[model samples]
Target chain A: AQRVTQPEKLLSVFKGAPVELKCNYSYSGSPELFWYVQYSRQRLQLLLRHISRESIKGFTADLNKGETSFHLKKPFAQEEDSAMYYCALPPFLNAGNNRKLIWGLGTSLAVNP
Target chain B: NAGVTQTPKFRILKIGQSMTLQCTQDMNHNYMYWYRQDPGMGLKLIYYSVGAGITDKGEVPNGYNVSRSTTEDFPLRLELAAPSQTSVYFCASSYSLGGNEKLFFGSGTQLSVL
Candidate 1:
C-alpha cells in the first residue's frame, strides 16, 4: 500500500527565515509527488509537482528516490506563506480506472512577523 | 467556468440523519473525487469515479456512499450521520490520472453532526 508521512503537525518560523516541510512516502514503484497548499478560508490548490520541477511562490520540492522523500522548501518565509501544507501521492496503478490520492497528515505553517 | 462546485456549503445533521452532498463540475472532467478534511489529519479520499456510472471506494469510505450517474455530477451520501463524520468535505476533478494532472478543488462543504 502507498502511504505518505508528514512528521510535523505544526511548524513556526519568523518572517524571512527558511522553512522546510518534510514528507516521506512508502511506495514500491515510481511515484508522482505533489505539494498542495490551503490558505485560510481558501480551497486547497496545487503548489507544485515533482514532474514539473518548477518552483511556485518561492517553494520547491525535489523527489529523492533513494530516501523516498519529497521535502518542500522556501528560502525566505513570508507572513502570507502561513497555511496548511499537504503532501500527496496519487496512486495510478491498479486503479482500474478509478484513481485516487493518498495524503499525509498536513503541517500547519505559522510565519510570525 | 465554475469549475468544481459543491452545494449546501454548510450543514448540521443530527445523529441517525441522512443527507446527500451534491457536487458538479463544469470542466467536463472524467475523473471526480470526494474527500474529507479533518483537523490535523489532512484530506482522506472517500470515493472516486473515473467516469459516469463507475465509482470506487478510496482510503476512507466508511459511512459514505457515492454515485456518478452523469459526467457532470457526483454526489456523496451519508447515512446515519455521526459526530465522527463532522468535517469539511471537498469535491475535486481532474482530466485524467496520468502525467502530473493536477486536481481542481471546490471551496468545500462544512458538515457538523450534532
Candidate 2:
C-alpha cells in the first residue's frame, strides 16, 4: 500500500536556527508530493509542492526519488514558523486513477525565542 | 474571494442524531473532498467528488456520506452520530488532480458527539 511517513512527532528549534521536517513515502511509481502547514488556530494550507520548487516563507523541499523522501527545510527559522507540518503524497495510478492524497502523521514544530 | 467556506464552526451532537456539514467553494473547482483530522492521525479522507453528481468513497468513508449536486457545493452527512465520530472536519477543493494542483481548504468544523 502507498503510505506517507513523517517520523518526527515534535521538533524544537531556537530562533534563527536551521530547521528540517522529514517526510518519506512508500510508492513504486513517481509521486507528486506536497507540504501543508497548520498554525495555531488556523486552517491548514499549502506550504509548498515539490513540482513548483519555489520557496514559500523561506521553506523549500526537494523530492529525492532514490530515497523516496521529500523533506522540508528552512534556514534561519523564525518564531512565527512554529506550526504543524504534514507531508502528503497522491498515488493516482496506484489507486486506480482515483485522485486522493495520503497524508503523514504531522510533526509539530516549536521555534523558541 | 472566499476560497472555501464551511458552516457550523463548532457543533455538539447527541448520540443517534444526524446532521449535515455544509461546504462550498467559490473557485469553481471540479474536485471536492471531505477529511477528518484526529490527534496524531493526520487527515483521513472520508469522501470525494470529482464533479457534480459524481461521488466516491475514500480511505475512511464508513460512517460518513457526501454529495456534490452542484459545482460549488459538497456537503458531508453523518447519520446516527457516535462518540467515535467526533473530529475536526475539513473541506477542500482543487481545479484538477494528479498534477501541479494544490488544494484550498476551509477553516474546518469542530464536531463533538456525546
Candidate 3:
C-alpha cells in the first residue's frame, strides 16, 4: 500500500522567513507526487506536481526518491501564503489506470506578520 | 464552465436520517471521485468511478453508497447519518488521457449530523 506521511500538523513562520513543509512517502514502485493547497473556505487546488518540476506561487517541491520525500518549499513566506498544505501520492503502477490518490494528514501553515 | 458542481452546499442531518450529495462534471471526464475532509486530516477518498456504471470503494466508504448512472453525474448516499460523518464532502473529476490527471474539485458540501 502507498502511504504519505506529513509529520507536522501545524507550522508557523514569520513573514519573509523561509518555509518548508515536510512530506515523506512509502511506496514500492516509482512515485508520482503532488502538492495540493486549500485556502480558508476555498476549494482544494493543485499547487504543483513532481512530473512538471515547476514552481507555483513561489513554492517548489522536488521529488527525492532516495529519501522517499517530497517537501514543499518557499524562500520567503507571505501572509497570504498561509493555508493547509497536503501531499499526495498516487500508486505509481496505477497512475493512469486510477484516479485514487493517497493523501497526507496535511499541515496547517500560519505565516505570521 | 462550472467545472465540477456539488449541490446542497450545507445540510444538517439527524441521527438515522438519509441524504444524497449530488455531483456533476461538465468537462466530460471519465473519472470522478468522492472525498471527505476532516480537520487535521487530508481529503480521504470515499468512492471513485472510472466511468459510467463502474464504481469502486476507496479508502473510506463506510456508511456511504454511490451510484454512477452516467458519465456526468455521481451521487453519494449516506444512510443513518452519524456525528462522525459530519465533515466537508468534496466531489472531484479528472481525465486520464493526455496526462490530465489533476483533480478538479467542487466547492464542497458541508454536512453536519446532529
Candidate 4:
C-alpha cells in the first residue's frame, strides 16, 4: 500500500515570508505526486503536480525520488494563499486502473498580514 | 459545466435513520468517487466506480454502500446512520486515460448524526 505523510498539521507564516509544506511518501515504484488546495467554504482544487513540473500560483514542488519527498514551496507567502494543503499520491498500477489517491492529513496554512 | 454536484449541502439524521447522498457529474468522467473527510484524517475513500455498473469498495467502505447505474450519477447510501458517520462527504470525478489523473470535487455534503 502507498502512504503519504505530511508532518505539519498547521503552519503559520507572516506575509512575504517563505513557505514550505513538507510531504513524504512510501512507495517503491515511481509515483505521481500532487498538491491540492481547499479554500474556506470552497471545493478542493489541484494546485500542481510533480509530473507536470509546472508552478501554479507561485508555488512549486520538486520530486525527490532518493528521499521520496515532494515538498511544496513558495518564496513569498501571501494572505490570499492561506488555505488547507493536501499532498496526494496514487498507486502504481491496479487491475481496473482505478488510480485512487492516497492522501496526506493536510496542512493548514495561515498567512498572517 | 457543473463539474460535480452533490445534493443536500447539509443534513441531520437521527440514529438508525437511512439516507442517500446524491452525486452527479456533467463532465462524463469515467471514474467517480465518494470520500469522507474528518478532522485530521484527510479524505478516506468509501466507494468508487470505474464506469456505469462497475463499483468497488475503497479504504473505508464498511458503513457505506454505493451503486453506479449510470456514468454520471454515483450516490452513496447509509443503511443506518450512526454518530461515527457524522462528517463531510465529498463526491469527485476524474477522466483517467492512463495518465494526467486529476480529480474534480463537489462542494461537499455535511451530514450530522445525533
> Best candidate, DockQ-wise?
2
Docking model 1 quality class: medium
lDDT accuracy of residue A68 in candidate 1:
97
TM-score of 3: 0.94
lDDT of 4 at A15: 100
- Measured against the true two-chain complex, the DockQ scores of the candidates, in the order shown, are 0.59, 0.68, 0.50, 0.62
Per-residue alpha-carbon lDDT of model 1 for B38-86, expressed as tens digits?
9987888899898999998887899999999999999999998999999
Q: Judged by lDDT, which candidate is best? A: 4
Looking at model 3, the pairs that clash are none
Instruction: Give the C-alpha miss distance for residue A83 in model 1, angstroms.
Output: 0.5
Instruction: Give the whole-model CA lDDT for all candidates, comma-separated.
Output: 0.92, 0.92, 0.91, 0.93
> All candidates' TM-scores?
0.94, 0.96, 0.94, 0.96
Residues B6-113, model 3: lDDT tens digits: 999999999899999999999999999999999877788899999999999888999999999999999999988999999999999998832237989999999999
TM-score of 4: 0.96
| TM-score winner, 1 or 4 | 4
* Candidate 4 docking quality: incorrect, acceptable, medium or high: medium
lDDT of 4 by residue, A7-97 (tens): 9999999999999999999986788999999999999999999989998999999999999999999999999999999999877675343
- Residue A26 accuracy (lDDT) in model 2: 93
Superior by lDDT: candidate 3 or candidate 4: 4
